[model samples]
Target: MTAQEAEDFLRTYRSMLKTWTMAVAGFSNDDSDLLYRQLEADQNVLADIAISYPEKSYSVDLLINSRSRTWAGYAEQRLPRPQNRQS
Candidate 1:
């Protein structure tokens, strides 16, 4: 993929991951498995793009890391009482 395409793909996948993570935070038990599968698929797509375009890998990695940190913070905030309060 071209640099522009890779950037666009990364942006799209990051947005999707954020959306899915929020969905899971709200009510995931009903379709947790499906959501997990979709998340994995999106991640795989990002990895493929990075591999196919080594020149754009740095930018892709930055995007992935930024999203991951955001997701981790959000997830931490949404965790249950005991989980969130643990030392």
Candidate 2:
């Protein structure tokens, strides 16, 4: 997406930040990755937006990216299987 389109995304995303966040939390690993890939694909535009909104820069895709990364981190973390007991 172009920088302008990215701007539009940010505007809309801000309005839905809370809902998007909840949705992200419930997303499966694959789904989370899909969203992350979509966002990361426009990293350049996001970075540009960062420059434009320095005050709340973190509110840009960085916020979502961080959450996506958190999802990935949790996805990689799993409890170990129980060992079999001796007879």
By TM-score, who's the top model here? 1
Clash pairs, candidate 1, are none
C-alpha-based local distance difference test score of model 2? 0.55
lDDT string for model 2 (10-52, tens) is 8765444434444454433345455555555655666677876
Q: What lDDT is reached at residue 10 by model 2?
A: 80
Q: Local error of candidate 1 at 56, Å? A: 4.2
> Model-by-model lDDT, in order?
0.64, 0.55
- Backbone clash numbers for all candidates listed: 0, 0
* After superposition, candidate 2 runs with Cα above 4 Å error: 1-7, 12-30, 61-65, 72-87
* Candidate 2 positional error at 32, Å: 2.8
TM-score of each: 0.51, 0.42
- Candidate 1 on 1-87: residue-level lDDT in tens? 677777888777666666666565653334534655766666766788878988777866775674456344334457564645534
